[model samples]
Target chain A: AQSVAQPEDQVNVAEGNPLTVKCTYSVSGNPYLFWYVQYPNRGLQFLLKYITGDNLVKGSYGFEAEFNKSQTSFHLKKPSALVSDSALYFCAVRVGGFQKLVFGTGTRLLVSP
Target chain B: SQTIHQWPATLVQPVGSPLSLECTVEGTSNPNLYWYRQAAGRGLQLLFYSVGIGQISSEVPQNLSASRPQDRQFILSSKKLLLSDSGFYLCAWSVRGVAGGQETQYFGPGTRLLVL
Candidate 1:
């Protein structure tokens, strides 16, 4: 079985400040990781994914995530925060060759102007 | 290009009432379809998936059931609605990728269900 963990329930940041949403995963063999964002009453939008090659993966909306195999972590990072960026973010993982994804509990991001 | 759509953006029903939610995909053929539920303030839970027409895989055992009657259509149904079933239902589709590769899942706008 595969699983994902997001340690933070909510993260607060000021506009123009850097932000980080933490994620970790446990799975057998290689892992395929993904990041998604959801606004209130809206469907989730894909941010990025990590399959292989280049530990640093760049995603939409000026966000990026670094995959650390040693720690089994894929942390989402942004150079600066925007009020519009405040939303719920989820991290998910799947084992190689599996089509199903196991998602984290989700972290709500709040950016104060 | 591909698009997924779910009908009845919001539904309110009494307990013990029948439930039905429809989802359809356009511009894609033989796509893998999935049904997921998200409770308030929680992550998504995979309820069912279909690899092809008439082939449904259930992840959780509940009153809710899913059927893929057409290549591009999937349906979620319940014989009797339960309060526990109240949640935001999402439909998604993905291309079947090769071994060791990852496929991106595209989601629908979702249907919010409330059981009274």
Candidate 2:
């Protein structure tokens, strides 16, 4: 079974400041990673995904993620935070050939102005 | 263009009462359907998925059950609702059965169910 872990429960950053949310995964074969965001009472919106190659993956809302095979991590990054970017973020992983997006507990991001 | 629709945007039900949630896809055929639940402010939890009509896969077994009567219609049903069932129910569709890592799941707005 594939599983994902989000070490941080919440992340806080000031407006215009850079932010990062950590994610890691455990699976049997090569992995496919994804990041998604959810606003209050809304369904999750797809941000980006990493299938293979080019360790760094970029997504919507000026957010990006780096896939590190050695560290078994895929951390989401943004150079600047906006108040509207605050939301619950999720990291998901699936073994190659299997697209059942197993997700982590999720990390809450809060951008302060 | 393709879109998904879910009914009763919000539902309030009493415990032990029967429950049913419906989802339909438009402008698409033979879609792969899924039923997911998200606890308040949490990530998605896949409860059921279907590759084709009458072929349902259970990812988690609890008080929920799902059925696909048509190629584009999926339904989540429960004989008796429970408090644990209270959460945001989401319906999603993928182009086809997942084979490798390229599949993307498109989601509906979702239905918020509150079990009182």
Q: Over the stretch A1-113, how does candidate 1's per-residue lDDT look in tens digits?
A: 78999999999999999999999999988999999999999888999999999999999999999999999999999999999999999999998775588899999999999
| Docking quality tier of model 2 | medium
Off by over 4 Å in 2: none
Give one clash count per candidate, in the order shown. Answer: 0, 1
> Model 2: per-residue lDDT, tens digit, B1-116?
99899997999999999988999999888888999999866868899999899999999779999999999999999999999999999999878755685777878889999999
What's the TM-score, to 2 decimals, of chain B in model 2? 0.95
Candidate 1 i-RMS (Å)? 1.4
Reference-based TM-score of each model: 0.98, 0.95
For all candidates, state DockQ relative to the true structure: 0.70, 0.64
Among all windows of ten consecutive residues in candidate 2 chain B, which has the lowest summed lDDT? B95-104
